[model samples]
Target: MKNVVLRASSMTQSGKYLLRSIQNESMPKIDLLIRECLQNSLDAAVSRNKGEKVFVDIQVGSCETKKINALFDGLTKELNKRFTSVTVDYISLRDSNTVGLTGPLKEEDIKEEGNYGNLRKLVYDFGQPQVEENSGGSWGIGKTVCYRIGIGIVIYYSKIKLAGNKFESRLAAMLIEDETSPKSLLRSAGLKNGNTSKGIAWWGNEDINGSSYPITDEDEIAAILKDLQIQAYTADETGTTIIIPYIDQQALEINANPYGTLQGKLKDYIGLAVQRWYFPRLYNKEYEFGAYLEFTINGYKIRGTKIRPYFQEMQKLYNITTKAILNDNQNVEKPSDIYIAAIDMNSTFSDGRTAGFVAYKKYNEAELSMLPPNNEPQPYTLLLRDDDDDDTGNMPVIAYCRQAGMVINYEINSAWTHGLPKLTEGEFLLGFFQPNGKKRLRKPDGMSGIEITLDEYLRSTERADHSNWEDKEVYGKKQRIIEKIQKNLPKKIAATYEESAEERKAKADQSLQRNLGKAFLPPSGFGKAAPVRPKTPGKPPATPVFKTHNLSFKLEDMSFSDNGSVCVPFSMTVKNGLDNIHLYLKAHTSQQEIDPGTWEKDIGSNFPAVVLYENLELYLGKVAYTSVEPVYSSKHVCYGIHISQLDSCYNAKGKITLQGKLYFKHNDPTISIRVVAEEGDR
Candidate 1:
């Protein structure tokens, strides 16, 4: 029978091909894989700590040549034991409903439908492949997904325990046959095991397809594992540890240029991933077992959990509690209230208080009877652990009632999905037994109970910031909650008549009359001509004012956007001897003077000469004004002056060029002055 079974297995190569596919297929993203593993670690710790929160701390740094390090600490030891070593040849980030071993590559099928990529080699590893019973990757294929990403091999699970005890540690690696192949890319540059002390433990090296062996340094190995200590959760007993000598190539690249890539990608979760996952380890001050778990990433402690003040505030605001039933019959009794702490998903990294809540009520002796059933004649429901209970060991971490029981399944991803693109489909409904608290919410078979979906009810709570949260549509029943919330918002400010189309047109018309130039407008463009201050009557100085010229303002072209904002253009010019000042419709005042130069005399509309400068854009602070104010400045003489603001004028004197239009009305019309000043005018 044994010979027949072996022969039958050898007859077909499908299993071999499948294993090869796992070793050579497109590797799952590295960071995402780490995130999943880290998430699992946190889940385990929090569960074991009696609902104590967890957190993830990440440290990024450089290592030996071509190496980058990601030190994960908080609650890291258990993760090490659970996943002592993670290879890249195979992995699956998403869960599934179907049976059979699903490939990580299979997940990409959800969008690509199998056209993505495939694995080739059967990358081997020694680590606990199953995160939980009946979970995918239980056969150890998941760790291989990391192997394909240039992580030459994994030499982890050597020796690590939670309580500093010994356990089964697996160490493994692969021999690369090709440089171009993603699955078997070698880390060593053709250096065999015998050539270096680091590879002394391995068997004699063999040269195959230019591939070589790379050994992990003992010091480097210890350093990384030490950093993971802060993330571990352990008792006075045993535990586990897993180590991968190298991270994925992409992760290394991201670490190389953190500012340009990795930092930006993990900006939100980088600080919290480790912390949230290993919350209990971070906050557990009661563990006196002397470092039950030690996790270090490059020798840095991944802090535990941070108690958010906002959540504390929310607890104060509402007396939170969950109401549940014991059985499926209408006569089933009701359970006590459960207080829940808020866990805000949308809040900023610094705002730990933005999350929703976890509810729990005080537990009692007879409460087990009142609690939802766990087996037949009942359904599995959310289990609320009593912190005050003494008889229930940590094993009660998972409550097992008679027939039906409760399960608190947190959907962290929902935080990312909700309000992104659009509002959640409906109001979050949270009901233990809402319509009637005493009615039995569990089913007879004890599968899924009739408990209310909390998400639907709680989501009904209105968003505080409509512009921020309700900027889009709310589907189905949620529309009513949105409408109800909308009523409470402050009314929009009333629009003013000055902002009306008619008023804007009148303003434009008025501006047109002013910018058309003296040739086009009448006395509006003509400014009073002041006598040029003559040089000392007799003595002739080195410089002299050979000529003086005066120019007038003019109007030009105008345009506006749909919003009614206007843009005007004009021109002006002035000539004195060889110096000729020509001002295009657009004149910058700040270039010629420190401040705005105004006309010494006022214009028709009580408006002062304007101060205009390039890049001096001010929509509300300073209105966009257009006028032709040209000035000519030369050594021998100065002439033709146009001043916008008083600050730009030298004793109310500046030469203006008689070239462009200057007819736009100065709304203030306060300080513009026209003066004739020449060189040597003293």
Candidate 2:
């Protein structure tokens, strides 16, 4: 049989635009490629069989361009014209023990339901709806990540068992590039005329009508696979293999250099990236419904036993959540080390079901030290940039996913952390949330409601990248459900660790009394009524100095700055004081005041930036005083503002008000202000 040639339909899409459309800013391109490809493979798990594990192999290597240059028709010309290279590095992802792209081989054969099947959806289609329920992909745009990671050329091969125990193999190739480029594959193939070419071309069996279809001849596929130096699937094997030629090796090695002595290879990064996003699925045996994912890179398997230690705590939390769902019990008791709190979406959204549960565990220095350490860097550190060696003051981290078990995101700070208590020194919090996929809800409609599963509700909140859940007004009243979930996450987590009401009130009272005594109370005999004495014969009785008993400082408003810092507007009133008043600003948690010096030392950053009041700025450990106005300076304990003597009689009847804005850096913890006032020298 003659080799297939490249073909492009009339008025198709530009490859460059398609690649850019699905670009994810939050994740690196290589990570995105791995995550999306793996997700698709999992979604295509064979439905006829149960208890079968899906096997995925990610192989990276280089091959001479001339060996397989003839397979892609005009691809060789474009490659030679664009890049100066003898060999092209490629990444091949193959999966078996699952269903391959099963669908119509031609576009006109699509069903009335607009079902393009896995083959068309992955290779030719864009933004198609997912046919299977509870599928991991919703946006239908994930496949573009493959094109973006390479030179916009990808080969597709799949082997599937047909009726009568017969086996069939499919092979095709696609090249997407900037059509505007003079050396574009579309132009070289003579498919471009002015703006007609979408910068996309495909290589396959060309029909009389010029439409391309996947080549079904096993001999042709084997010849091409042999030339490319990729292993061909056996006759009995079933699954898909995606080959991305001319991969940008440097793009895959972007953050690999940070890992000391790892040689910054693609395999090292690929292993960690797999564990970072897919740990929940790796070697998971508790849940029968969840797919068991097996991964390998360069023929070396990523063993679950070896990588489990790094994510043992999180994995345990995931298992607990999974077990709760499996047992049909949402109210799971908190264990000694972990707290499993059920997020009751029914309470807020009136859905009559729990959205999910958040599993939280605080690891102190001693607890973290007891865990086994791996010489290789932790996956979270490489992916999240969080240093695990420094166990103190690690911000409360939470990773959330859906029923698919692919982590949607790992967030250190977000709306889920708001109103949550701050972690103490030498401690950090880790949590994971998975929505109740089995539960169902009714989305609001005109005079009626559309029933949907909680998984679908949450999936709607995710964008194309599936990084974070956001509330879009298009979801209608369902948006309120998303909002409630975000608002309730911290509340539920706090409920698990918060102190009793009486204990809280007592603590609050102590903090209030301490701050009041230091900031409001005057010294002995300064504000008290003095005893009268007879005037001396040669001297007049001295005039009594009035004490300021009505000094008030209140926080008027607080907001977030553009850079995520905190801005506080405050008002201070002085009534009937002729003495200099020293004011101190402190960042206070529920328990006690945070010492600026101690905070800077522990947190690895300055406690907070200087508090600006008009033309004066107050920092830590420094004091600046104006002749007739207030003195401002940063102190070791707190920021200080010193005000000189004020007119006692003039401002006695009317309150003299001072208002200013206090600015704090973005990294500063959530805290209330503690203002202290003391009498200073005249």
Candidate 3:
């Protein structure tokens, strides 16, 4: 055995791929970035407030060409005592504490206060980057994308400090410019002096230059901070006031004409993106955040209103959350649960994605007759929501996508140039995010909206996560939602076409007769006949003439006892009745009127007297048993003829003459006729 120990190589593995930071200018737009920032602030406020009641004031005006200001404040307090204890070695500590932050951070530590970093500096600055050491910080590079766009940011931090018997308050503001090496500048504007205001003095001396302009009153700053902290009780006074003096170059690029148009568009785009990811900042009561972003041209402030998908419009387009159950286990009291959230919209704007409607339909229908033949499958549209109000937009159209359990977070890329999906003529953009957390986009085809295949979606999900059975659950839920949607599709479509109740009822009745006739009533020894009747006397006489298909018959009436045994008062006449008609009749001497929407067992038959005489006759006129189809279509043949007193059956090879009018008992349920007869010959 070799006794020499294995020696490690002096030179380590090399050639590790170094990812170059893409220039932020290549990003889509600042609108999306600003929106995301504003969202972060709002989320911070909501989390602190315990509800979504934070007020966001956006100012889009300019002291120069144009400026945007966002103020987020709801629940806030003074900085914790720990911040005061934070060591500021300024030399070796700066290098060790510097790297790159995973998320947004205060500027005082990132750059020298009151300094600047232009585009070149941002790219070439050798100064070490400051990284977020806070456990609550986000993944790196997300917010950097915003800063790289050259959009200025100012953050004001206010926190409560708890010291022995005495509380202190403090405010810190740091502003950054869009340059190679951004500078963190502190505004000397809003400052206050109180007994033992050591933290305030220290922060100011380190970050801001003392100034006397703009009413430099320390007492006023303290009062403002005190009042701004909602439900905050601190032994000392503390708060923050952020001010941004510079705007993003891309934001400046947007056209400022049409006051609300630019702002509205940008807001919409940005608002959607913010709605996607989680907002954890709003959960802390120690901080209340909001934004007041304004867009202006020259110096005039521009006004804009938010846009949202109206609930009323949504009601028109699609249904609310739908539920379904799968019958996998018969013994289980609770079947498998499935849920699908889909919004249907008008077909015209579907492709444009201007309307937030989704195309939700069943995947298994052989022929979805409820949908117009021209109609195709489309994906569910994305809806825009404002945590504040609805009716924020005119055009209700917007785009949406879903795959399995995952759906597109419109709030992530609303303002990104490439993020906005395109709409085509007769073709809507469909996006689906599956439970397996995958995304799929589909284009509309023909009159039908875009159709996302369930099989394909499920298959993709299975491939993505083999171990996650929950993916299958998601697919099941989506399928259930689709089924629920399909169940109500006919009614929804009918509502659009404005189909009448009578028409609907008639069609339904016909359908029922065709599909479920055997279940309701089986075929007796009767021939086919159109269920029509000729008006006659309300009650049958003792003996009357029975008129049938071109034939007549007179029969003697024999009166017997009651109890539905035998009652033939006199002779009966069968007129217009065809020859060779086999007839069996029962006479009811009672008189009554049937009420609507009511049915009774043994109710009088609903057949005509003439056709009823045919009894078990299968052939009428020259038409044999096999020729029944042609005779019925020709309209030259008749079936059963039910009289006033009873029903009569008839069938014949040729025309036959009959007798006088027949009578029937009014409101009788037991009398029915089964017969076949001919009406007219060529």
Candidate 4:
């Protein structure tokens, strides 16, 4: 066995550049590493072996530097120069009950239409498309996450059973670094022969052509595994093992205070990450196609029985979604505390069969405290955290995924969850969305009308990291399936939380007088006692010329703007004849009413910048001087329009209608504006 460092060539990607391909700031680098590795492992599970559970084991430990220094030929001197330690920390991941990288060993043997195999795809290729249908990976760049968490040195070992019951084990290693760096190990190794370094090196058996191939000698593989202190797969076992050497333990524990020790914190994080991304498939037995996932970290098994306190709510939500899909979403019983709804997400580009389901639940502090205590935090806190404000409390979160059962994203304060109601103190809302993978869809015209599953459709919308679903344009037109989902999801959730039967009855009774069109109104004395008049009658008061028959306002929509401001759109109606109307707005809070003029003094922000009325933009703190124009005063927070002015402006005599939006600098959704309409000037 020998080490092979490629010579720099045109358009070649440096190791440092490749390592940064999967950088996700929202999640910790350690968590990202775990997620990507497990996703690939789950995707490689053997499908033919029914009822066989797929198990993944992650071992974190250290090995003496001198013990395995000889494994890397050209990079040994550089390793010793960089790390000043007797032992090197490492992380190993092994998966059982799976197919272990079965494919042609040589690059020239690959074919366009034939199976590229997992071995070549993972070890040699970059950014290749996933050949498997409904697979978790799409861009194939997720493998770079391995290099991100370590010193860019990773070893791969896999054992596959051939057709004749013979077993073959393949072992290889790769080291990546910024070859251009003045302190680069590859540069220090002098492997480039005075030429620029490609920043990549591979270790394996050298063939006659000077090309490196995986070491297939079982004896050699066993010796190396023992030296690295990695648990080897048995002779009869078939799976893959990944070892990343020289890991930064402190880097993995950044910002995490779950445990007192580094190892404890690492273990807690690994377990939480596994449950966060794979809870849907963990111990699930509902779907025959869904593989059960078992996870272990440093010899500690993460089983459903012990981790229930951390993920019980999410598990329940997953069950609700799967059951709805299994029953064809027809007449399925839902839990009283949970609200489940399904939406037909089919569009013009679809085959008229695609659908997505959402389930929502609210938990109070009391209910949350019932879970058993543990060193790690609950999944809700991890899933529903507001990225912008740490102390803003838990916000409404919607965890969404495709049929693969791995969560694609936890959406908070995004367009996908724009209309969800704000959570009050002491409670939070959790929601889950899954597209029906079984539903088939066909592309629109100019694209050959090719059929694809809903799962495939959703996968097309994911970026390389598979973190969020985005809108993609096809044939120069927007697909808009995601748009439709976003637009309809909150409406469905709101409908599920509709008023109770008794509440509806009471509302009906209160509105019955108005619903009867004012014809069946009761007389003043019809059902009451007689009135008492004053002894001396005074001069009757003069009646006003203008009277408002009906005045009402309704909030149409409320949402957060791009700059973290609150936007409110409302509509107001003014019935009957009127000479003038004055609209006063006050900041309404639970404590007191604050006039718009003093909004800045009370709430530390200015009033709405402007109130929009159709094409007329009325700037607050200004006033109108003409019939078609409007203005305001800095001291008085009033918007007044004369009926005679409206008559001359638009020829609408004695009638006025207003609909516009108010843009406030404040972001608190709980704060509202109260509107009071009066006759003439106040």
The true-versus-predicted C-alpha distance at residue 661 of model 2, in Å, is: 20
Better model by TM-score, 3 or 4? Answer: 4
| Candidate 4 residue lDDT tens string, 1-682 | 4888776777877787877777676677766777788878878887624355788999888998876777888777777777768899998899988889789787666676646788878887677767677678888888888876787788999999888889899999887777767867777778763377777888897777666679999899999999898888886888999999988877777634333323346767777777778888776665334467877888778765456453667777877887787776724677888888877664543444437788888876445553234333433455535242222234677788887668887777787677666554345677888777777655656566557666787888887788888877755566777778888887888776677879866654443322222221111112321232444566542211212344444444355444333355545455554445554445555567666556755443335333332333332124332333333435222232332333332224544565655543322334554444455432
Residue-by-residue lDDT tens digits, candidate 3, 1-682: 0011111233411111001122323224433344333433332231222222333333322231111111211101111211233221100000001111111122333365524221111221222222211111122223333333332333232333233543333333222222122221111222223221111111221214322112123454454333333122233333222233234423534521112222334434334322222121212122112222222222232222121222112221222111111211112222122113223323322222111123222121112111333232222222322221111101113222221111123322232112222222122222221121112223335434444433333333321111111132331233333233233333332233355869856754553343222211112232333232444689543323334444333444332222211222222223344223333332222343222111112332121111112222232233323222111101112222322311233324333223321222211223332111222332
Candidate ranking under TM-score, highest first, comes to 4, 2, 1, 3
Taken over the whole model, the C-alpha lDDT of each candidate is: 0.26, 0.66, 0.25, 0.66
Cα displacement (Å) at residue 64, model 4: 1.2
Model 1, 124-235: lDDT tens digits are: 2232233332111223343433333344333222222323443222222332223333332221232222322121112111134222222224344445434432122233
On residues 407-477, what C-alpha lDDT tens digit does candidate 2 reach at each position? 88876657877776545444567888877776766544554555667777678777777787876553354
Give the residue spans of candidate 1 off by over 4 A: 1-30, 46-50, 53-145, 148-150, 158-240, 246-682
Candidate 2 matches the true fold with a TM-score of 0.70
Question: What lDDT is obtained when candidate 3 is compared to the true structure?
Answer: 0.25
Error of 1 at 521 (Å): 22
